[model samples]
Target: MTTSAATTTETPSVSQTKTGIRFWRRLCRNRLVTVGLVIIALQLFTAVFAPWLTTYDPTAQDLAVKELPPGSEGHWLGTDEYGRDMWSRLVYGSRISLLVGISSVVLGLVGGVVLGLLAGYYRWLDGPIMRLVDLMFAFPGILLAMLVIAMLGTRLINVVIAISIWSVPTCARIVRGSVLSLKDREYVQALRSMGAGDGRILFKHLLPNCAAPIIVFATMRMATAILSTSALSFLGLGAQPPTPEWGAMIAAGRDYMWTAPHLTIIPGVAIMLVVFAFNVVGDGLRDALDPHMDVTYES
Candidate 1:
């Protein structure tokens, strides 16, 4: 009897898992989402295997072969103004861009969720926290990031911090809205009435319920983070010279734009492609996760 009862209880969960798998398979059929996933996967793979993919060091320079156009002397994408292989730098640069984007989003997500939960759950904290969020929103994002970068100094970690700080307000607002809706739900009230602690109620009940929006927002925020990091690097506030960061490479190549356009164009395209991929993926997530959307998967 015990074994039979356990089997009966597990069946619904197994069925739900199969249903989720089918839904995901249907979601992946969207052409734009598939392309975005492919592009992102390729970038991550290239970043991870950069050393094996290219023989030349990303930072190595040869003045003798500087500014060679694409397809010259076996350099596939050509050499930059510094004669460093553009293709190698690009491959390596993906690591930095992805790292910064992902790390900053994580930092923002953690801080934002905490603040958002506090504000949404407690009437006393809401006004002050929202006012702070408004203050953060008042400044243009890039400008606020630049200010923080200026204060913190320009290192890779500092760049992540600056971008994360900029991201916090937006994340907080999104999470707060979600939490406000969830905190009053029946399950949350039941948990509270059952003598569950605030921590449990927030983490177990509220946070999980709000996860879809949080995930969707984080996906979209990653694209912005990448673009912002690139912009900061271009302005000399991000990765230092010879760091193989895409934005820093663009900055180095800007002076040579007229003489060697490939230097600028290659890295620029890399940034565009990565950002575009993230945006498309975010859009797809929004559509897939939206409760109001009517999604039907054909059998």
Candidate 2:
């Protein structure tokens, strides 16, 4: 009777401890993670409210006021090469950057996950798929993107597709590793023994288990995608001039580096902040989602 009572008492204590740990893990309880979340939230807000946040039309250019420094009447962050408000363009331009970042990541994730899952599950398909993935891996991501863009003729959608192709190999490699590790686990073997279909075993049982790594990879990939977009735009293969893109803004401002430094600095800072935010968040997720890493919360 006493042992039974003790067991009951310990059960709730264990449950409570697990609950507390889960709470902390969900948010990653790390200082950098919190700061990253705040920065990301602010960027999202800026993107969502770009129209209301900016007082001037980003594309409406006044040649007379070109290259005005910050704090000139209506223009807060000053004017660019064509006298368009820098602040307004940066805010609106975020929408494009983020849109490309997220969409390309999603495309890459879908392609990678599908291919990796199949390659890992079926030994027959592994050689061909892995050899192709190996070929892609041999090329630097940016160079591969540049080559694809050059071949595709510099269209926006093609740029996204180009980046997505480069992104897929990395994600596929990660997922393949995960699936390879998981295939030998008892749960997977049990499912196989129980006559579970390959599709059910792969998707329902295996894929969900890979979520943590996938989420981390997706977050990191956002930064990569944004960088690729900016590089493409800077090279004139991305968003055209007068289109309020951060890369183009910096590209245009490069000639005035000796004089109108803010033109390049502002957009450069925006790219840096966005990339930094994604990286911090990705690192936090890695720590949080590591099941073996115990998170001790101090009240």
Candidate 3:
């Protein structure tokens, strides 16, 4: 009885210690990641509660107050060319940016993972898929997006599709590199020796190991997708008029840049902040996930 009781107590204590160690390690290596989380959370909150956060409807136009300065009586970040409230528009627009970024990344992740796994696992299949990936990598991501939008026409769904297409090659390359390393591991060889099927070995053994790098890449891609979406919207190939997109807002505010510099500055800063936050967080994730990294700093 005493032995069992002692075992139970020690087991929980050991687990608790491990949990504490993990928490401390994550905190130490990921302070920027924590800050990024806070920023992203704040953005999500603003997007979710946009109506409650602002008084005026983002779409409501009051021509009498058109182009009002910041902190105007009825408007906060001022009015746009259409006399729409800036603050409200910005708050609501967060949803469009986040939605586009996340959806595009997710679609890219799924497609890339499948194709990458197939290419890595089957030597005969590698040539065609890799050549396609190379073709995608040849073009600049923004230029590719622009081309895709030009072909697909300027709709929100087209923006997502365009971004997804540009993202897949990057994700495929990352996954392929990871799989190249992992496929030759002793455990994988053992699984093959045990007569494991290709499907099971690839999905069960290889795919899970790709998580760390995939996550790191996904975070970075999220930021990139957001920036690309904004650029597209700015060029009138993304979100349409009165949609409160950040890039569209910047485009609309360009004429006023000389008179009310705040117009472009606000949205531009917001874009920078969001992208910076994701990059910092991605770096933290990469560091934390790197098995070769040392947790203890040598004195």
Candidate 4:
């Protein structure tokens, strides 16, 4: 009996190790995903080590040296109209963008998952919740966010709240679909027959099954959140001046575009790269996780 139990435990351990190895092999097979991972890693590194990477304060202004071109003394990417170091601002700005993106998505995910669980699992709640989701979906995301910001007044945290609220419908829809499909599966039916409580069945079984799609959607939505944050900042409704946000920096540099294109171009490139990286990574994750995809392994 002892030997049999030990063998059973060892078999599961070996199976789990093979599963993990297969996942990594599939992930590495996608070239675009590899590139995206590298870019994302670099952005994270920049956000975490901004202080050590740059000598100039992002908010510090030297009016006398305004609009210094790229490759100018000390300032590699050059100075904006405010004469603040572009490189430093870009480095620090990554922190704000990533923070807002991640936090807002998490907030949305929590709320969305709860609502979706109710909508999917309970027949009585489905119609009402779906109608509410439809109402939210009627408005464009950014427009809804702007309206919320207008009503709530502009602040960093307010921006996050607005974005989170705007994101709820999308997340809810995704999760509800996943839950609807999962709730009727044999495993869920078996659990129901086994007298599993609603909470236990939903939380332990349904939610865990919905994780892959939710993760992919969240990754993609993060890019959208970053873009929305930048747009709001550009419109003067997000981060205030001297905060070293990329969008605000671009807005500040727009007037001097003819004379110092680097100011606008550099930050624009940074935003583009980050968004693109997230999108590619999301695609990669979807492909890797998709059971329908015929993923090949190298022998």
Candidate 5:
């Protein structure tokens, strides 16, 4: 009996490991996913080692050397209008972009999950929470962000808050739909019949089953969060000047577009790459998580 119980106890862990390995294999089968992973890894590495990656202080300015072209003497990738090294500012900007993206997604996902869980599990709360979610969803993400920023005023933290709030409605809907399907499943029903409390049933049993969609949603949402942050900054409602944020850098470089186009081009390309990476990875994740896609994927 003890041996049988031991085997049963180990089965779930072993099955989970096998599932994860299968997911990884499926994800890596796509060459674009490989490229996306490499880009994301490099971006993370750059953000962590930003100080050492570039010698110049990103915020420091020198009028004398301002607007120097790329590969001109010690400064490579040129200097912005403020004469700060573009390389350094770009490197440091990765830190801001990643921080905002991750922070906002986490906050949004948490709020969304809680609301979704309550709405899904308790029939009484469903109408009110879903109506609130509907109201939020009525506006575009950028518009919602603009309204939030207008009310709260602009700061990096406010950018996070705005983006997070924007994210919540989408996330909530995703999770709510997932939960509605999962709550009536046999495992959840079994847990409920076994006298497990609602919290345990909701969090322990139902949540795990809902994870695949959430994971895919969050991965895609990161791209939107980063892009939105940059957009707001570009409009002068996000990061202030001298912050070395990619959007702010582009905003400053707009005046020099005719002469030193690299100022805008460089950061624009960075934003494009980062957004592309996240999107491709999100697609890969969606494919991997969806059982329907499994038969289509090359072995």
Candidate 6:
């Protein structure tokens, strides 16, 4: 007990730095993680350098070249019904998808962490917060998002807000569970006994301990958030037409599916690849971060 408190109170940075190094080393050792990282890196690179990667403006139109097949003239992935360059829109669309995914996760994380900390630390707050979370959980994730969007009205930012609100329940529950398990630990008790304030104890000590699950949740949530954003856009509750968002593009192309399959196929493939990349990466992180997740073979 003394040793743990001493370690927790003293040299936290040094210990954390060493632990992070070990964690990263273990993470990089997985081949699946390597592949996930490569895919994520490529998507990030494409998102960042979208303009340079594709010459045509994503929104520009030319009726003469509309609905062309892949490899038609300068349009490598072909043009949509509006003659908008599919490749350009796709590259640009990465920015929107990644942006929305990251933003909503961050917002949800903030709200969840606050609610979780309060609920776990304060006996009086637990019931109310948990009940609120339960209320949120009563609705399916997509349906909850839809409800929020219904009230907020459709737009890119609205999509992020709706998704973040939908995300709060799961994130809060995960964090609350972690806090419940951790709040009674020797280190936490020691901190409390040492006259540490709640803020310091919760944020400085408890938060760090809860990081692994939160990180795993956030990573997995990224895929869901991105998918949700696309789903909303597909359903016309997200980025409107002429915006070139992947989901909007998919929605637009559904009408031309019989005549111009590439319009739908290309963007759909992008969503699939991005979502798969995040899922694999999230899984890898979960395995690496979870100390009790060892697999054993019985004789």
The TM-score values for the models, in the order shown, are: 0.95, 0.90, 0.91, 0.96, 0.94, 0.91
Alpha carbon RMSD to native, model 3? 2.5
Clash pairs (backbone) in predicted model 3: none
lDDT of model 1, residue 290: 66
Q: List the residue pairs that clash in candidate 1.
A: none
lDDT of 4 by residue, 74-168 (tens): 99888888789989999999999999999999999998999998999999999999999999999999899999999999898999999998888
Instruction: Compare candidates 3 and 6 on TM-score and give the better one.
Output: 3
Q: Decide which is better by lDDT, 2 or 3.
A: 2
For all predictions, the C-alpha RMSD in Å is: 1.7, 3.9, 2.5, 1.6, 2.1, 4.5
Q: How well does candidate 5 match the true structure in TM-score terms?
A: 0.94
Candidates by lDDT, descending order: 5, 4, 6, 1, 2, 3
**Which segments of model 3 are wrong by more than 4 Å?**
1-24, 27-31, 295-299
Better of 4 and 5 by TM-score: 4
Runs of candidate 4 with Cα error greater than 4 angstroms are 1-4, 294-299
lDDT of 5 by residue, 1-299 (tens): 99999999999999999888888999998999999999999999999999789999999999999999999898989998888999999999999999999999999999999998889888999999999999999998899999999999999999999999998988888888888888888887888888999989888888888899899999999999899989999999899988989999899899999999999999999999999999999999998999977677544
lDDT of candidates 1 onward, in order: 0.89, 0.88, 0.88, 0.90, 0.92, 0.89
Residues 1-299, candidate 1: write the lDDT tens digits.
99999999999999999767765765586898999999999999998898899989989989999999999976989998878898999999999999999999999999999999999999899999999999999999999999998898999899999999888888888878988888888888888888999999889878898898888889889999999989999999999988998888888888988898989899999999889999998888887776544445442
Q: In model 4, where is the ten-residue run with the lowest total lDDT?
A: 290-299
TM-score of candidate 4 relative to the true fold: 0.96
For 24-113, candidate 3 gives per-residue lDDT tens digits of 576456677888878888999998998899998889998888888888887868888778888999898899999999999999999899
- Best candidate (score: lDDT): 5
